[model samples]
Target: MTYIIGRGYGRALLTPDGIFFKGPFRRRSIPWAEITEIEKRHHTARSSEWWDLRLVRANGRDLAVPGAFTSNRYDHKFEAKLALLREYWQRAAR
Candidate 1:
């Protein structure tokens, strides 16, 4: 399954092996066993509040699941997406 992020430009792909992320400039793959944490992150800039995901790896790398466009303000089903991601992580992570 795949989750669209930030106006459909970014995405997170979930598979039996792990999760994959592709953004404008970077790409990352995290195996289920290597994931150490999955958490929601809140960012505020001036008058806007943004919600995104923070995934930590065993090697201490952090990955963000984009929830909104860089030029956009409102979140798009952030809580729902986060919950779903967590569900997958819980089932797969060791």
Candidate 2:
């Protein structure tokens, strides 16, 4: 069984073969074999804040996990989830 973490109303799941993400508007799966890179992006301007987690595939497509961020200065839970994803992704690849 895959381990899943709840991200607000969405969720991120790590399975034996891939990663699964479900958000309000989109759902995505990235097989370990197809993943070329994973990245975290953040942008803050004036009163707005944005954070995204992106997975780059070997076929040149990118899948993003939206709503994985907060405007608050300390988001330990968010950071932990991102770290967990990275760690499990590496493990699945191996």
Candidate 3:
């Protein structure tokens, strides 16, 4: 049971078996096994939010999770989320 604190109403969570995300206009889950990669994308000049989470799936689909108000703005929260994601991903790899 893992939860990533959101800056606003959005939230990202990692359970024992999968990842869950709920945002203003997006809500979805990626099973640990189906996740292939997680990446941080560069923010545009127009965007103050410097970081975003890109979720890659085994089927080649990609989902972008905005961490702007919450995870990206604060001190290393994005990294923290990444670490947890990696941990769960490793478990799935096994």
Candidate 4:
């Protein structure tokens, strides 16, 4: 389970097991099996808003996800990060 916290550069992934983040900016890491799902959504700063959302998953979890990370805002700065998670997931899945 993971969710996006903050906005844009301040985005962070809140994983149930471990919160993944990179300073004031969102970092991309290898997608992981534990991830369950990664959703790219920008809910209105207003409460009670749900739309303009995109997500990815490994299991059956659907938590909030940041865009800066998945979107490669840093030009794949998160490649390693995502790779790490993906590597772990691959091993686990195997």
Q: Please provide, for model 4 over 24-48, each residue's C-alpha lDDT reduced to its tens digit, 9 standing for 90 to 100.
A: 4446543444455434344544445
Rank by TM-score (best first): 1, 2, 3, 4
lDDT scores in order: 0.70, 0.72, 0.68, 0.44
Candidate 3: deviation at residue 49, Å?
A: 5.8
What lDDT is obtained when candidate 4 is compared to the true structure?
0.44
Per-residue CA lDDT of model 1 for 46-68, tens digit only, reads: 97765667888899987766542
Per-residue lDDT of 1-94 in model 3, one digit per residue for the tens?
Answer: 1223443457777787888888765688878888888876666565454566677889998776545323245657667766777787788778
Give the lDDT of residue 22 in candidate 2.
Answer: 81
Q: What is candidate 2's lDDT per residue for 1-94, written digit by digit as tens?
A: 1211334456677887888878665587768888888887787889787676777889898766544666655688778767877887889867
The parts of candidate 1 lying over 4 Å away from their true place are 1-8, 67-76
Which residues of candidate 4, in runs, are more than 4 Å off? 1-59, 64-74
Quote each prediction's TM-score. 0.72, 0.71, 0.68, 0.33
Best by TM-score: 1
Lowest-sum lDDT 10-residue window in model 1: 66-75
Top candidate when judged by lDDT against the true structure:
2
Off by over 4 Å in 3: 1-8, 24-26, 46-49, 66-74
Give the deviation of candidate 4 from the true structure as CA RMSD.
8.7
Task: Point out the higher-scoring one by TM-score: 1 or 4.
Answer: 1
Residue 68 C-alpha lDDT in model 1: 29
